[model samples]
Target: MLRTMPLTKNLTLEQINHLIDTGHAFISPFGLNRTAYIVINHKPFMVVVTDVSINAIQLSGSWYNWDELEKMGGVFESEFEALKAVAGGA
Candidate 1:
């Protein structure tokens, strides 16, 4: 499946991180599925459903898998919680 339409517009790394940190970023519904914008080492990345049935997520434009994402810094319920997790070294 060719996806011409971008899931999100071109946002700078700082903008993306700001959105995530400020709790503006969210898991947006996409064609009955969902997508999330994540930041790793100040780099913006997207995680989207590859298989709804299995509740799988694939890093957009990259081969990095879910495990890698978890290792980098898994998704949290809220940005605040994520910040706490990092602070506490969780």
Candidate 2:
């Protein structure tokens, strides 16, 4: 569980951003309104990005394999900026 996993505590903003930017799964279309996931962790944490203009971001969705994120670019700097701009808008 999250309480037992030390990695959860090690999770940093930079790391989270990196995971979003270059992660195996990039920002893809989610719904008719251009929704997509920007997170790379299997801990019920999913960063949702909608209305890129406002840069709305939110963490929702079920848990997935965090390791999967490493397989991709592993994250990017832009993702960090966007996430902060919207404060991961819910």
Candidate 1 global lDDT: 0.52
Q: Which residue pairs clash within candidate 2?
A: 18-75, 21-76, 22-74, 22-75, 42-64, 57-88, 57-89
Top-lDDT structure, candidate number: 1
TM-score for all models, in order of appearance:
0.35, 0.21
Tens-digit lDDT track for model 2 on 1-90? 333222355788887687668753244323323334343342222344332211232223333233444342222234553354345442
- Enumerate clash totals for all models, in the order shown: 0, 7
C-alpha local distance difference test of each model: 0.52, 0.38
Task: State the TM-score for model 1.
Answer: 0.35
- Candidate 1 residue-wise lDDT, 1-90, digit = tens: 954333366878888899779966656333333554455763434455443212334444444455665677765434554565566554
